[model samples]
Target: MSWWGKVAGGAFGFMLGGPLGALLGAVLGHSLDKGMKGMEGAEELGPGDRERVQTAFFTTVFSVMGRIAKADGQVSKDEIALAETVMREMDLNVEMRNTAINLFNQGKADDFPLDEVLDQFRRECHRRNTLIQMFIEIQIQAAYADGRMDGAEEQSLLHICRRLGVPEFAFRRLEKMIRAERHYAGAGRGRAAPPPSKPTLNDAYAILNVNADATDAEVKKAYRRLMSQHHPDKLVAKGLPEEMMKMATQKTHEIRQAYEQVKSARGI
Candidate 1:
C-alpha cells in the first residue's frame, strides 16, 4: 500500500483502539481489520453496520481534507489537481473518487453540518486521537504538496493547529523544517539528520500552550481555546483548503485527550 493508504488504514486501527480497542483486537487478531469481520471473522458484513462505518470514515476523512484545502480564501485548481492525484495514487476508483469529491464539496458548503458529522464520526470511531492525527498529518502533507503554501492555507491549517491542541508556533516550526528539507532535496543540497526525538509528550505542556503549573481553570481554558481554533467546522468556514479536515479530526481528539490528561494529572 502507498503511504496515503497506510495512513487511512491506520486511522481505522486507531479508531478501534479507543473504547473497543481491546475487544476488537482480541477478536480480529490483527491491528487493522479493514476487511475482517467481528469475532467470528465472517466474510459477510451486515449491511447496516458496514455502511455506517463506511459513511463515518468517508465523511470524517474527506471533511478534514476539504476543510484544509479551503483554509485559504479560495480553492485553487492546483490543490484540486493535487487531490485528484492523491485519489489516483490511492487507486480509488473513479466512482469512489467522485463520491469523495462530492462529500468534500458538501463539507465545504456553508450549511453542511460539520459538527454533526464530527459527532457521528466520534460516536462511530470511538474518538481516538492517534487516529485523528493520522488523518491530520495527511492533510498537512496535502497542503504542502506543491512547492509553496499560500497564506490562506497556512491560516487555515493554523486554525486546525489550535483545535488539535497543537501549538501554532511548534507546528509552524515543524512545517518550516519539513519545507526546508524538501527544498534541499529538490535542489540536491546536503541534508542534516533530524532530531532523534520527533514531537512527543515531553512537550505536552508546550503543545497545550499552558504553563507548567497552570491552574485547573487555566488548563481548561487553554484546551477549549485551542480546540475552538481547530474545530473542523470552523476551519471549513475559515476557508482552509478542504484537504486538512483529517487534521481537524485528530486535533479535536487531541484536545479532548489533552483535557483529560490535564484533569487527571491535576486531579481536577
Candidate 2:
C-alpha cells in the first residue's frame, strides 16, 4: 500500500511517531499513537516502515510551505496560487490534495513550531542530504513565488536554512538559480524570450553550483552529481512521492540546460 493508504487507514502515526506524526494526526483529527512518543526513530528506515521517511517528507513540505507563504505577514494570491499549482502539478488525488491544504493551513498558524519541526524532519531523513536539499529548494521556490521575496520571507528562509544545517552561501546560490530558471523556462530555444537575464554564463554557474574559476572537469562532475540527485526514477526509489516526478523531471531539465550552456561557453 502507498504511504497515504497507510496514513489514511490510521496506521501511520504509530510507526512513524515524531513531530511529523503529530502534525499528521492533528491534521487528520486524531492523536498519533504515543507508543514511541518522545523517542527517536531508527537512523535508517527499515523494510517494514520504508514509508516512514516519505511520510515525514510529505508532512514537512506542506506545513513548512504554509509558514513560508505567511512569512511576509500576509498570504498573497501568488503564494496561494503556487501551492495550488504544486498540487496540480503533482496531480494529487482528492484526498491527498485536501490533506495538503489542511497541512498548509496548519503551518500558517502563528504558533507553528518551526524549529522543532525542522529538527525532527532532519532526523527523520537520517543524513539523506539529497532529500534535505530538495526540501530547502522547495521552500525557496515558494518564498519567491510572488516573483520577489519580501524581507521577512528572506529572513524566514535563512532561518530555515540555519535550522536545517544548510549553508548561507548554498541558499544564495539556489536563489539565483531559481530566479534564472523563471526566465529559462519561458525562453525556450528559438522562442520570443524575456530579457537576457537567465542562461547567462553566471546563471549557468549558479544552477550547477560551481565556482566561476572551477575547471571543466569539476563542472562536469557537479552537473553529473546534481542530475543524479534529481533523477526522477532514482528519487522515487529513494521514497520521493511518485506525484513529485514532474518536479524532479523539471529540475533535471534545468540542470541539463545549465550544463549545455556551460559546455558551449567553454567549448567543452
Best by TM-score: 2
lDDT of every predicted structure (CA atoms): 0.52, 0.80
Output the worst ten-in-a-row residue range by lDDT, candidate 1.
Answer: 187-196
Query: TM-score of the candidate numbered 2?
Result: 0.86
Candidate 2: tens digits of C-alpha lDDT, residues 1-268? 8887887776664566656767787777644544345546533345424477778888899999999999989998777877887788788999889989999999999999889999988777777777888888888878867777789999999999899889999888778877777656653222222334545878788888898899999999999999999998877766677788898898899889989998998998
Every model's TM-score = 0.44, 0.86
> In angstroms, how far off is 124's CA in candidate 2?
0.4
Stretches > 4 Å off in candidate 1? 1-55, 119-124, 164-170, 173-268
Off by over 4 Å in 2: 30-48, 187-198
**Which 10-residue span in candidate 2 carries the lowest summed lDDT?**
187-196
